[model samples]
Target: MGMMFPTSLIGLSFDRFWKLKCLSSMGFQSLTSLEYLWIKSCPSLTSFPEGGLPSLLLHLSIEGCQKLEKVCKRDKGKEWSKFANIPCVEINGKFIYDPDSHSD
Candidate 1:
């Protein structure tokens, strides 16, 4: 969980990154090409970076993050809008929020 790589990283997945508490503000921001991201079982992760997720992220799934409350406030803003175009999002084995389903 404490590593850095090229900014060209297209896809990243963190499975059982136990020690990661809070994601860096610039973590996903710099990964402009990141499309798929999956995080699982990082029990210490309480929340997301204040800046929000990457703009090009198409798929995101997180599970077993018991401390996490919300990805972002449910509202019209930069943080919320980041997920507006995402095709798929799943949390804790369930799809809590879906753009296609909520559009109606």
Candidate 2:
């Protein structure tokens, strides 16, 4: 995957970033400056890698990815467990079920 930062980007409070049919299986990583990410119609993308983004990420949108089952799976002793407090994450435009939730 090509790793090149766009030249026009400055004062990076990006409200939206869209990638369609171009993102590889690797997925975009380390976009710490991005606020909202829109990934659509990328069928090959199955799962986001563990520890994929900066902790500052606020909004994430995933849609039309039929093959994706989970956004990020918890790997024991991995940073995926730390995302419980990241504020907002949506899968297929629906709120994700908190893996940490329990029934009593």
Candidate 3:
């Protein structure tokens, strides 16, 4: 696990990370109970943790992370498969994936 992520946690918030760069994929996948992940203002972040996110993750939000935002290009993202099962996902204040919002 990196400095911010630990194992078997319920949820975590990544806020205004001015110096954070990258994360290993293995660490976050071990978070069995992790349901929500919030990332904000990490300008230098170019990618998600390498492999994938935890299976139990239900919500994901990304804000002010331009580089990472480009990588997570909606369904075309490099890590799109990792996000497929997630019920909700947001990027730059927009909902990339939200099952409930399609009620129109």
Candidate 4:
């Protein structure tokens, strides 16, 4: 994804990208209208983009990406800052950040 995704896109998913390793922050930031993103089965992925995910991102789902999940475990994660603001986040079917359970 090189800032070429349709701006009208609101949801996106990355599935079974076995060779995918990392993504560029700027590339995702350009998705100004993006709301939800899901990634699965990319075992080699270990990190998020450099700066952070788009502020408009409302939901995030990650599965089967053990290395990346380990690096994004709530506040203790090295990439926590990138996900702290997303209202919804699910890792391996676990709710890491759930708006329904969050209190102020």
Candidate 5:
């Protein structure tokens, strides 16, 4: 978590956000209250943080992120499971991965 916020942050969106090359492993694992996250037009983005995202996150969308290759691996990496319970996940205007269906 690069910056600590009050335990009340519910939604966050990054539109055309530049300068940051990556969003993962920046301490998002500490955002216990975060429910929604939207990232758009971040062309420089490449991948997620190694530690993974917060557990409370329910919604995630990534659009126009041309450089972003993979949002965590399919079912191997530690960060992969962090997104396993999310209800909605959209990438580039398409609903590709479904985390809930991979549950145990």
Candidate 6:
């Protein structure tokens, strides 16, 4: 088997699990079944893969990533627009883009 498990992982909740700090890379390439992702205080993480996350991912939480600029951007094409409408991603305890907020 691979370093982790198979592709089907629904309702998976990861909270403050400090072990992630040592992991050089997190391979979720085939986690097509993942629905919810919760990550916090991973100070060493720089970025996720460049193709965006699984289409089934509903809720995503990322915090304390002081070095992260863009979460996931398409390597080619106009795929950046695909993420323009998704509403389930939460970054730094706020919605990805809030019209009323000046921080964006």
**Candidate 2, 1-104: lDDT as tens digits:** 46555533222322223333233323335454655555566665654545554456576656666555243432332334644445675556665555643112
Report the number of the highest-lDDT candidate. Answer: 4
Q: Extract clashing residue pairs from model 1.
A: none
Q: TM-score per candidate, in order?
A: 0.72, 0.53, 0.79, 0.87, 0.72, 0.63
Name the runs in model 6 displaced over 4 angstroms.
12-26, 69-85, 102-104
Clashes of each: 0, 0, 0, 0, 3, 0
The deviation in Å at residue 104 for candidate 6 is 4.2
Q: Model 4, stretches more than 4 Å misplaced? A: 1-3, 98-104
- For each candidate, the alpha-carbon lDDT, in order, equals 0.69, 0.48, 0.76, 0.84, 0.70, 0.55
Question: What's the candidate order when arranged by decreasing lDDT?
Answer: 4, 3, 5, 1, 6, 2
lDDT of 4 by residue, 3-60 (tens): 5677778998999888888977767866889899999999989888898888899999
Please tell me which model should have the higher lDDT, number 3 or number 4.
4
Off by over 4 Å in 3: 1-8, 98-104
lDDT for each residue of candidate 5 in 17-45, tens digit (9 for 90 to 100): 77668775545766789999898988877
Measured on C-alpha atoms, candidate 1 has an lDDT of 0.69
Distance from true position, residue 41, model 4, in Å? 0.4
Alpha-carbon lDDT of model 6: 0.55
Q: Write down the worst ten-residue block by lDDT for model 4.
A: 95-104
